[model samples]
Target: MRIHHHIGRRTRSGLLAGLLAATSALAMGIAVAQPGTAEAAASLRSLADAKGRDIGFALDPNRLSESPYKQIADAEFNLVVAENAMKWEVTEPNRNQFSFGQGDAVVNYAVGSNKKVYGHTLVWHNQMPGWTSNLSGSDLLAAMKNHIAGVAGHYKGKVFAWDVVNEAFADGGSGGRRDSILQQRIGNSWIEEAFRAARAADPDAKLCINDYSTDGINAKSTAIYNLVKDFKSRGVPIDCVGFQAHLIIGQVPGDMQANLQRFTDLGVDVRVTELDIRMSTPANSSKLATQAADYKKVMNICLAVARCQGVTVWGITDKYSWIPGTFPGEGAALIWDENYAPKPAYQAVAEALGSGTTPTTPAPTTPVPTTPVPTTPAPTTPAPTTPAPNGSCTVTYVPNSWGNGFTAEIRIRNDGPDPVNAWSFGFYFTAGQQVTNAWNATVSQSGTQVLARNASYNGAVAVGGTVSFGFQGTHTGSNPSPTSFTFNGKVCANG
Candidate 1:
């Protein structure tokens, strides 16, 4: 999910200056609250724990030596995924000859910090050495099985999960399987073989099929959905699905929750793996705000799905984000900024995790009975007919705009005499603006009309209580706000 790159070392002066500023602020009787500090009270790790989810970051072992990086990694996250150490090239670059030095370092760090380790991958086409590509037929098959056994067996009980096969499906079109060396040499059966081998090596660890660009109900995701469905029917030992949510600003998929739900409905856990929202840098306030909303949307999506286990950001800080190198002019992709300071995205993520409802239903140990796939696809938009009026409410809309995009915070208050247990707030966007993503609710747009429903955790509102959610959207020429709103199909007063 990430391209490995070496970051130039930073001098100690930045850390020194940060400490000096904190000290000065403290001496002047000003409060300086830093993430993972007592003054902050809540951390991403602690918040995630309360929600029964793991907050994780991809760790670069090289950066573990730095005090600030180590501190943040230890204090803010409860799960650790190696950025490059566990990949094919790093662990088994020269055929049967293997090395586990760097991988061990990462595992040791995770164990020392009491964080769970999620192995990056066992079978991937891109990171394999040139020798792998040269072999075909039985020779290649043997090598792959051996590699899986060796690597998965080594980490046996140490890792909680393993990405048994990564990025095997191609993007675009019908989302056919990728024509990787493994695919061509061992044929389509290679994927099943790899999973079987991994299970043999580590019976306890959860095995997953990880892929990118499948965060929504697109061609690629549908392909993965069919694969998982097939795997379940044939009992192919897949315990989880990983959606590598490498997204762009104002472009988080609106159907992310629905997509993840469909996977979990198949009786396997789902995870947001290698998540980072990138934007063209030097990050300005507006871009950063939109980025924050995007991050919260992703977190909320994961939280909304009962079987979604956790979310792991690609990296801890923007300084080492792979975006800059892999994507020209796109650098600020992580929650933490380059100076090791928390950005708005960090705060938004923390809040979302903290407010999310803990799932009550446990993941199914045995595969649930499968239902026949409907020949007709489900409608993406809600029903056109409005529901009968149920209650009275009021809505407050606040928007922040930059260029053609904007982020809005909406507050809906219960004005009726009785408390509203579950509600849906609706509005019309008159300016041809379209919502890209939202958080604290499940938001969907059908043309100019948009509907926002309460998430699991925030469904109940007291007689006078209020529920708030935010979204990011785009507009072409005139960005006009919705003049009217509805709550549970009844027209609500504008605030």
Candidate 2:
């Protein structure tokens, strides 16, 4: 489900549990529970791993020739994709041929480190052994059956996911060329056969249908969606739809995130498979800058969605890019350069991941308060300016279906044990998902801040009445929870 040149480093950029601070370090035999987390349910949501990134390579065992495999073994990627190493030819060359040397190496490496392994595919048109092209009817089905059973059964529970079907829909339309064996020999039903056979082999692995030219909302993408939709309706056992974003330098498909969300809304997980940014030529400065922007945008979109679980870069470096050898006149589509040094795009990715400190965008700003007007007459004594109350609010914010925004309610309490004038709370959301609605609180979004107005309930909370401040806002890349929630000049613990 992914493509790449050789092994190189594309430095890249997911979620984690609620970021709770440890007031004190662990002092032998002591543990502290994080507050505000929902209690563990009998069957918890899989949102824990709902975000990730990928690693892959071409059809070569010599990927180690580029550098010590340890280089990638130490990276921050969440998953590793064994590109062509698992294909029919490489995995099974002759009759009953089962060569898992290269593929096993990658899998073992990933497993040893507790990372996820997404089986490249059980069926693919290219890289298939030449002998397969001549098979027909029963022979074809038997061949496919053996292929799926052998590979899927071999890995089984060890795999986190499987690319059961790849490139099933073609950009040229008509479900791809009629001559393609998958269509010609067994017809489109082969896809279902492959999935069913794979499930029979390994019921635990999440099965996905991966394809290129379907990363955006296009004809081919639509066709694939309908197929998957119908299959799911009929209990076909499909779990996710993979978007192959083998993008150009600056042309990442639009509506890619929303497209993924729609599929997620259908109750299927979504992933970005075989992601890469190919330039007109390698080492082009302008192209590299654009590639940086492209990488940032890709990470931003994935971070903006809740069900987008994984994103695997086609490969790590541009030096070994599949573009030059595969497409000719195009290459340099990765994060690392020939020297294995990080590229600008790589650094941008690190920043997007929150480990790097390069400021790609401005920081969110807080709204300013208004000052009292002066009296020109100077005759009457100026009335004393009212002071805001020293109250606090409890806001339980839940990120929405899309990672772009969240919803919450802030409950105000008179912490100072004294009645005061009003309560005002303000904070900034980098993307400003916007405040859809609010009550007992006036809200507005500008630049990146959410300004809320809260007057004492019943003109003053009567030394006991309470006011609440709460609203939702869109989230951008690499940001943690909002740190600025205040009521009457005092910051709330969690806002």
Candidate 3:
């Protein structure tokens, strides 16, 4: 579901003081930490607080009764968005017959927890009642205005921001307006009318235009960008733009940061709304590690942008994730798993958010040796010694292919006695494949030869250990994998 409205911009600095106090409390061990190593123990909310940005999750009201679900929700997130309770159908199912029970439950929980509420959708194409589609012309416009007024006015000060308009643009090709009932009957002017009504109802809220598949600079995002530009020029009461970054594993766009920068350059805040990266599951360690890296990459991107307000994952845990039902054979989207245990992704997100903050205690200095041992001088005559065997490696390429594009996960295993430090792997694509984006490594291509160097966090490969990275590419005809690979200039066996 999607909604849109025009609300005012919020002052981010105001949140810093309170958040800092909360962060201090957390560091002092007053707050509950997830089960793991010391570094993974910091709550995501506290880490994000130190950076002056909110880390949020969509609340499923039904799950609020569950101990584990509510525990994580209250402890890890600073803001809450109702997954479906605030939508048009749920808010006002039968025209003028408003129901705030479900919506109020979510809002009440957020208020009690001292977390801010983000009202989802005042006007959206999906999840509206059948009666809404029956109306036409002037009647339709009036209904739209009434719905926005009722919903926005009720949650007036409670909601810090609103997704005033959601998914207004078409999906593919040369993106244009979607042919929803509102668009067909009331025309494009309906969007502006909805925003106007929302502004009048709740003048203090920060309003936004939200959409999916526009996390990167693509045709769909460009279309929304044009709309935002036009809205700003005409004094449309929009304050932010929401990128529903519903991503796939290893498919994060290479230009994601640049794309967000362009939107924020237009003088409106940007948010990563509805974030969840899904992969084929029955989860495995390899896929979970990749997911962790992807989540870290996203959080880092948001931190890099000055006007990115915050990030809100669509759901709190994988058990309640919408991916498994919507996209069969795909699950394990959120940082927490089915049993509500923290996964590698939880640590990754915490580390990313904590990157900008100073440690509570200073790191200990390394001790210097007072006396150095004498070293033996080199002999003029060469002394014979047993030679050490060269390191061996194997590369396994697994590709998920489609018509003209594919994503491949490549794993490099070190099969030698000694560890490979600061490793570099090189290979060639023989099927006219061109890599477009990659994760967990720094990959560069010159013709068919591609070189992938380990990232700062994954530079060392221990003996009998493996490191994996993936890339998305386009191919024509046969998409054949490389028959061989080289690790640190030594040819590796193919797997």
Q: Report the number of the highest-TM-score candidate.
A: 1
By lDDT rank, best first, the candidates go 1, 3, 2
Which whole-number lDDT from 0 to 100 does residue 477 have in model 3? Answer: 65
lDDT leader: 1
TM-score of each prediction: 0.67, 0.61, 0.65
Q: What lDDT score belongs to each candidate, Candidate 1 first?
A: 0.74, 0.58, 0.73
| Steric clash count of candidate 1 | 0
Error of 1 at 425 (Å): 46
* Higher-scoring candidate on lDDT, 2 or 3: 3
Residue 181 in model 2: lDDT: 78
Task: After superposing candidate 3 on the true structure, give the runs of residues whose Cα lies further than 4 Å from its correct spot.
Answer: 1-40, 355-495
Which wins on lDDT, candidate 1 or candidate 2? 1
Q: Which ten residues in a row have the lowest lDDT in candidate 3?
A: 8-17
- Deviation in angstroms for 272 in model 3? 0.3
Q: What would the per-residue lDDT of candidate 1 be over residues 1-495, giving only the tens digit for each residue?
A: 335442211111001115444444345343335321211123466567557688888887888776557756755677898877888888887988889998999899876665789998898877786787778679999998999998998999899899899889887777899888888888989999999999999999999999988998998899989988999999988999999888889999999999999999999999998888888987777788899899999999999999999999888777777777767787788876665656667778877976432111101121111111112222335335444345578888877665676657687888878777778988877666777555445677767678787654456777687767666566776788776788877777778
- For candidate 3, write residues 307-375 as lDDT tens digits: 998898887777777777667798888876665555667767878986322211111121110111122
lDDT of 2 at 455: 22
